[model samples]
Target: MNKLTPPTRLTGWGRATASGASVLPVSRGNIADAVVGAPERGALVRGLGRSYGDAAQNAGGLILRLAGLAGDAVLDTVQHTVTVGAGVSIDDLLRVTVPQGYFVPVTPGTRFVTIGGAIASDIHGKNHHGEGSFGNHVRRISLLLADGTTLEISPSQHTELFWATIGGMGLTGAIVDATISMLPIETSRCIVDTTRAHDLEHILTLMEEGDDRYRYSVAWIDLMAKGRHLGRSVLTRGDHATVEQLTGSATSSPRHYDPRVVASVPPVVPVSLINNLSVRAFNEFWFRKAPLYRTDEIHSLAGFFHPLDMVGSWNRIYGPRGFVQYQFLVPFGQEDALRHIVERFAASGAASFLAVLKRFGAGNAAPLSFPAPGWTLALDIPASFSGLGEILHELDHTVLDAGGRHYLAKDSHTTPQAISRGYPRLAEWQDVRNRSDPTGVWRSDLGRRLGLIA
Candidate 1:
């Protein structure tokens, strides 16, 4: 066992808030010991720390860094399934599986997330309309309970605990490993279609009409545009490219998979670099650069699904104060509410450079899961912006009133009242959690702040 590191300052990917905790790196063999000997502040498992908010932080507590628990991925090609360590990142898993003609059934925008993080947050992706969130593909999970007991949980066994742990945000317990179903593919490329929507209505209509035709779809909206151009967007939709679609070297090596980070942001930058004026200009250029109508463009898997991954430490561009990723989902019928929220962001002069919109299909049984059959929009706003908190709080009410909810993975400021209203299954989730961890051994900053754990 490795010695525990001294109390260190840690923050989420957003880097807006900071907390200090003693980080203990533990392997599967020693995880039990660490949990059993945890301090009064309790312990929480942490993965790659990609959550945009405090979901993984445990102030004054013991942080179990699971990276040391990584093990080789066991692939069962016959069953199209893989059992990977909780610490294994999606990027690492893809490096091995993509060449084997298989891919993660569901992947978020960034491939740096760990398997444990994926299960804890029930991450969704562009293909959610077709395959649902990561939890849908999960076959089994090895969880370490607060009582230092390790249990193998599946949908049919320990069913309630399994579902609650899906989006339980690591409060259920420390995920040790997981067996997941993989999606087979002929190649590592995607056959993509692109179109530019003139306004909010046009884009929503286009997505509603044709999104089902593609396996993956997403729209990049220009939140800075107002009036006639309000919510103008570039819609890109696609699926894994077939072998026949590949040519030359790609045809012979159709399963080739390699993702590289082309650039890294400086350690520090001036907040002024991301002001409304600069972001608006960038958004305009970005929108104009997309083809009015393009079809069947072959793109690498990384290029298509994780563009931001191409730039390492890209969040540094947001400067010292970092940025907030506010993502909310409204049911299919709440188009008016979606439009109202977009209009509010446009009118607020918020400097949001990465604004994305996607449609989610039916949600799974995870009580805290963010997706539903609705329209979901995610925006990256500079945290230094004045009145940004107020703007988001108001948006929260609008979303809740529309029968929608915010993604806990990206939330830092949403009130507990809003959470209770959004997730009606909270009581059910809490019941399962309490039974599983009556002593409250599993805890996090998010859990305490939101009253997720009693």
Candidate 2:
């Protein structure tokens, strides 16, 4: 095993809550040795560090970087399935699969995330309502337990550990690799339908009625809009375009997949770039730019699923104070609570540039899984905003009261009390984790922060 590197500062994609840890980059062969020899603070596995919070950090202890374990994706073209190393990124996988007429069944907004991080977070995307989170498509995971034993876990095999590890935030074990089913696509384009809703009610009605017809759907809500315009949004929903739908030059190369980063944010930016006035103006321009009703618009896979990926280090735009990404889900009937939260953001003049709203389908058996049959809303707000902490706390209370829960991947400020209230099955998950790691060898800042483990 290699000696740990000098302690270095690390933070989530949100750039909030930075911490220092002794880091060790490990391959599959050396992972067990590093974990078993970890210091008193224990070890946590980190992948692409796309998590918005500290889910991957282990302060003062050994931090395992799995990027060395990455290898070429193994694909079964006929079965539409793939087995990838822990560090294989979604972008890397797609670059190979998309050209061969296949795509990831589910992908979060960013493609830079690793396969291990995706499973650890169980990320969901626009198609979550139709398919499910990354966990649903996961067939098996190779997890390295605290005792240095590697086990291949599936839903029906070692069921307890499997479920616990899905959304357990890497508290159970280190994920080495995963096998998942992929979605077959005829072309690397999406035939989308776009519509602009005047208000929250209009957008909700449209989605509730039409979402079932589409394979993927999502809305960019204007949280800065107040009064009657609260939650006014631009809804874009679509499915992979069929070969027959392609026209002109597109028909010649129907399976081309190329995503490029047009620009990157400089390392430093002024914190004031995202204030209320700027955000409101951007929102207004975005809302007015979309057609009231447009159908059959051809969009690249990257354009439709990951517009933000077009700009590298876009989070840097939030500046030195960093930002907070608050994502919460309320049950289907809790539309009132969703409305209230939107109202709160609008009334408080919160400058959220990227406010997304999506509908979730039934959640899987994973106790800590974030998705449920409900309406989910995600917002990006500056961490330095005055009263930001209090606002988030109040919002947490409202969500919990409505039988809602927050996404651990995006959470930074939620209290242990809110965690208990939101995830009632957490105790069950903990029990399973304890059995797999009796000495609690697996640990992370997120686990300690939420009191998920002792």
Mind giving the per-residue lDDT tens digits that candidate 2 earns over 1-454?
A: 3466889999999998788899888888889989888787888998888899998888888899886332367889877899888878899889988998889999999999988888888899999898989999999999999988899999989998998889888888999988899998999999999999999999999999999999999999999998889889999999999998888888999999889999999987866478888888999999999999999999999999999999999989888888999999999989999999999999998789889999999898899999999999999999989999999999999999999999999999999999999999989998999999988888889999999998
Per-candidate Cα lDDT values, in order, are: 0.91, 0.91
- Give lDDT for model 2: 0.91
lDDT of 2 at 11: 94
RMSD of 2: 1.2
* Candidate 1: count of backbone clashes, pairs at least 3 residues apart or interchain: 0
Off by over 4 Å in 2: 68-71, 270-272
Model 1: CA > 4 A from native? 1-5, 68-71, 270-272
Candidate 1 clashing pairs? none
| 197-280: candidate 1 lDDT, tens digit per residue | 999999999999999999999999999999999999999999999999987778878998888999988777766468887898
Using all chains and alpha carbons, the TM-scores for the candidates as numbered come to: 0.98, 0.98
TM-score of 1: 0.98
